[model samples]
Structures are given as C-alpha cells and as structure tokens.
Target: MLRDFSAQALFMGLLTAFVGFASSFAVVLHGLTGVGASEAQAASGVMALSISMGLCAIVLSAWTRLPVSIAWSTPGAALLASSGAVEGGFAAAVGGFLICAALIVVAGLWKPLGRMVAAIPATLANAMLAGVLIGLCFAPVKAVAFNPAFGLAILGAWAVVGAFNRLLAVPAALVAFALVLTFGIDIPDGAFSAIARDLLPRPEIVAPVFNLPGLVSIALPLFVVTMASQNIPGIAVLKVNQYEPNPGPLFAATGIFSFLSAPFGGHAVNLAAITAAMCAGEDAHADPRRRYWAAINAGVFYVVFGLLAGAVTAIVNLAPPILIQAVAGLALISAFAGSAMNAFKEAETREAAALTFLTTASGVSFGGISGAFWGLLAGGLVMGVGRFVAARKAKKV
Candidate 1:
C-alpha cells in the first residue's frame, strides 16, 4: 500500500474531495433546512454525512482494492429541497431518511430488488433529475436580480474558471463569493463570533417518526433519486474505467453507514458518480492497482472536511440565502446539462422524459407528496402508453 502511493494520486484524491465539498455544501445545507432542520441540526447533518461517506470510501477501497469513492446524494438533497417540509417536520424527515437507507440495504441484499432498481429507464431517471435541478439552476439569474454586484462577481468568477477547467469553476466562484462578502459587503460585528462558536460540529440526534405521507413523499423519492442518480451512475463510472467491484456489497456498505448516520441528521450516502471518475480514471494513477490509494486519501480528506463542518456551515450562513442558492445552482450546471442530454437523447423516450422533467420542475405538491414522485409516475404512464401505441402500430402493419 505504501509503494502504491504516488504524488499524482494523492493530489487528485485531495482535489476531488475539496472540489466536491466546496461546490455542493450549500445544497446540502439548503436541503436539510428545507426539511425543517435548525441551523445546528443542519450543521450536524453535514458533519455526519461527510464522516459516513469518508468511512465508506476508506473501508470499501481497502477491502476491494478498487477506487470506490462514496458521496452524499446530491440529487437526493435536491429532491428534499423541492419537497419542502412534510407533515411531521424534521423528525418525519429523519424517519424518511431511515426508510430510504433501509431500502438501499434491502436492494443490496436482494438480487431481484437490485435488478428492479437497475431496470429503471435511464431516460426517465435522467429526466427526473433534470427536472429537480431546473429550478435551482435558475438561481444565478435570480441572484443577479436580487443583488447585482455580488451576483455578477460570483457568476463572472464561475464563468472565467469554467472557461478553462470546469471542475474548478464552482470552487473558484465560492472563493469569489468569500472575497465579495469580505470586502464588498459590510459584516455585522458579532457575526464572526457567532460563526466561530459553531466551528466544531456536535452531533444532534433527532428521533425518527414514521408516517405514511413522509414514507411515500420523502422516503420513496429520496430512495429513487439516490439509487438512480448516484448509485447506478457510480457503478457505470467504475465499470467504464475497468473496475467492476461487486455492486451489492458496496451498496450495502453505504446503506449501513447511511442508516447509522440518519439519527444524527445525515441523509443518504452512496457510491459517488462524478468524483468516482476523478479517482478511478487514469489521471489519478498510471497503474490501476495503485488507484485505491486515491480513494483512501480522498476518504481521509473527507473526514478532515467533516471535522470543519462547523466553520463551513457558519461561512455559508453568513451569505444571503439567495446567494448561497446561486452558488449551488452554479454547482449543478453540469449535472443539469448531463441529465438533459441523456433525457432527450432517445427519440422513443423523449416525450415521457419531457413529461417527467416538467412535472418535477413544477415543484407541485399534492397530498403531501413531492413533484418528483408525481413526475416519475406521470412519465411512466406516458412511457406505457407510447409502448402500447407502438405495439398496436406494429400489429396493424
């Protein structure tokens, strides 16, 4: 393991963790608060998620000798953000998180269930994700309207960095945001002190309370999004890079950690999609056998980052909510683009995918259920009708 370590791999691993967290931490915070977590609880949630994913990455990489990066479910967070507060509030949300984690564990243990989850159409899944992202992606423009100076600076920084290295764009924008906050705007005298007080995150366990509405509305959608957007794509990423570790055990490991962390305010954890590529790809290491070190290093970095959750959360809270959201929107641009591309790529599924995207993007709520769940349902119905019509046409011909 010592011999396998290389400067390139170590750098790549740390870079992946830094970039991933900096880009998306806002979304995680927003998601937790959207579900009714207090500021402290949200900070705890971030810490729990970071530590859990970190441990998962470390253990999985060591056991499999593969670059198996784990991540908090970004799309799942987006789903929660859109879903808003349910009947029983944050406790209910915690219950839903537990349920989702249980589902993931079952999927890992049960072959047929895993197969069924895998059978979800890629177009529909991508469309659902795209729809969830559409509203959030508009935040930069909204930020410009709300606070022109700060907004423009943030957007400009993102644009400039993206022009060169897309991966660095959001992190660069975050830096620009910090600079603008420091020099461009006035800070309240005691604000920094308040932020400093929360520098070290303390876990706050919220007891889970299961209810039918939360189960259908939050749990099911969270499960679907995490599996479809994170887990399935994560496997594909590793497979593409010629690392085919067993999916079941990996899923089970994430599921277990997610379950353990949920009581402490964490949401879902799963195999990473984007960062997995960073660690698993050739850029991480020339020798595939040595690439596991990248994942290990990433895990270590993630744990350290988790320990700094308080500071990060405090910094984010210092900004206007819209600005934070704007940064998050910028972070999700690539995901939205990718989802849109795949959602419309197939002519046969285009209409269904469009229906899904529109429904999810609408942010509609009915009977306590989120637009994402309704969107997937509506899309599936359309897909079924399309298949039926195609079959009839074939018979007539």
Candidate 2:
C-alpha cells in the first residue's frame, strides 16, 4: 500500500476534499440554521459531519481498497432548508436525524427495506427534489436583491471562474465571499475577537426530541432524498469508474456513522455522489488499483477541516445571512437543474412531475407537514390515477 502511494493520488485527494467541502458547506450551514439551530449548534453540526465523513471515507477506502468516498447528505440538507423551522427546534431536527440514520442502516442491512426505497419512481423522486431546491436556486437573485454589491461580487466570481472550469465555480464564489467579508462588510470592532475566541472546536451534544411532525417532515424526506439523490448515485459513480464494491455494506457503514454523529447535531452522512468521481476516476491515479489512496487522502484533510469547523462557522456568522445563502444557492444550481431535467424528461409523467415541482416550490405546509412530503404525495396520487385510468381504458377496448 505504501508503494502504491503516488503524488498524483495525493494531489487528487487533496483537491477532492477541498472541492467537496468548499462547494457545499455553506448549504450545510444554511440548512442547519434554517432548522432553528443556534450558531453553536450549527457549528457543532458541521463539525460532526465533517469529522464523521472524513473518518468514514478513510475506513471505507482502506477496508475495501476502493475509492469509496463519503459525504454529508447535501440533498438532505437542502430538504431541511426547505422544510423550514421544525416544531420543536434543533432538538426535534436531531431526533429526525436519528430516525433517518436508522432508516439508512435498515435499508442497508435489510434487502427488503432497500428494495422498497429503490421502488420509488424515479420521476416522482426527482420531481420532489426539484421542488425542494427551486427556492434556494433563486437565492443568487435574492441576494442581489438584498444587496447588489455583495451579491454581484459572488455571482461574478462564479461566472468568470465557472467559464474556465465549472467545478471550481462554487469555490471561487466562496473566495469572493471571503473578500466580501474582509473588505466589503463593516465589522463591529470587537466581532473578530469574539469570533476568534469561539474558534476553539467543541462538540455540543444536543439531546433529541422526537415529534410526529418531525418524523414525517424531516426524517422521511431527508431519508428519501439522501438515499435517492446521494447514496444510489454515488454507487453508480463508482461503478462508472469501474470500482465495484458491495453497496449494502457501504450504506450501512455510512448509516452507522450518521447515527453516531446525530447526537452532536449532524444531520446525516452518506456516500458522496459528486466527489466520489474525483477519488475514483483516472484523475486520481494512472493505476486503477491505487485510486483508493485518493479517498483516504481526502479523508485526512476532512478531519483537519472538521477540527476547524468552529472557526469557519464563526467567521461565516459575521456576514449577512444572504451572502452565505447566495453562495449556497450557487452550489446547488447543478443539483436543481439535474433534478428538474430528470423529473420532466418523460412526456407521460411530465404533468405529475410538474405538479410536484410546483407544489414543493410553493413551500406549503399543513398540519405540521412540509411541502416536500405533500408534493411527493400529490405526484404519487396523480401517477397512480393515471396508471389506473390507462388500465381501465385498455380493458374497455
């Protein structure tokens, strides 16, 4: 294994960790804040997720000798962002995280449970995700509306750098945001001192408070999105790169880590879809057998980053919320586009998909349930009725 460690693998691994963390971490922070987490709680969540995923990536890569990357559930975070504040605050959200993690574990250990999740129609699944993301996708514009100077700076950085390399766009936007924080926003004289003091890493264990509304709204939606959008696609990415490992064990491993981290306010962690390519692909190494080193390398950096999560969260909190939100919105644009495309791709299911998208985007809530759950329900009902009507027509003929 030591002989297989090439400079190329090391570089790719470092790059993978940077891109993965830099791109979507804002989304994680935003989502955590959205669900009524205090600054300390949100910081703890980010810290927990980063450390757990980093360790998971290392263990999985070393165990399988495959570039099996792990990540916090980005889509699940987006779902939380869309779900609005839970009825019982961050504690309730943590409770949901526990439930979601348990579901993931079950899905991995029990074939029937995994199969049931897989049975969800792809179009409806995509539609529901699209609906959840549409609002955040517009945050760039909203940020601009909130403050044209800061917003445009971030967008401009993304646009210019994105033209050169799409993968770096979000990270570039993140750079612009740092500039905005440094030179643009006027900080209170002592804010920096306070942030510095808060930088010390400490895990805040939030006690869980389970509620029925939280289960249906947070746990259910989070589980579905994480599995469908992150875990399943992550496996496919690895397969595309020709590194096939048994996915069930991988899923179970991530679930176990997620469960362990939930008490510290982490939402969820799972197989990484986008960054998995970076670790598993030829870019990681010339020799396919050695690509696992890249993931392990990335894992090391993730742990390092996790240790600094408190600092990062504190720095981010200094800025106006919209600026961070804009960056997060930039990060999620690709996810939203892909989901929208998949949702409406088939003509037969387009109506149902559209309906789902519209409803989810509307951000409706009734009886303590979120729009995402309702949208999925509505789409499934429409699809079921359509299928029934078609069957009846064939019988009449």
lDDT (tens digit, per residue) of candidate 2 on 1-397: 8988989989998998899999999999999888989988999999999999999999999999999999999888888999989899889999999999999999999999999999999999999999988788899999999999999999999999999999899999999999999999888899888877877798999999999888998999999999999999999999898877898999999999999999998999999999999888889998999999999999999998998999999898889998998999999999999999999999999999988888888898989889999999899999999999999999999
The residue-by-residue lDDT of candidate 1 on 226-281, one tens digit each, is 99899988999999999778999999899999999899889999999999999999
Candidate 1: lDDT of 312?
A: 84
TM values, all candidates: 0.97, 0.98
Model 1 lDDT on a 0 to 1 scale: 0.91
Poorest lDDT segment (10 consecutive residues) of candidate 1 = 193-202
Residue pairs with colliding backbones in model 1 are none
Off by over 4 Å in 2: none
Clashes of 2: 0
Extract clashing residue pairs from model 2.
none
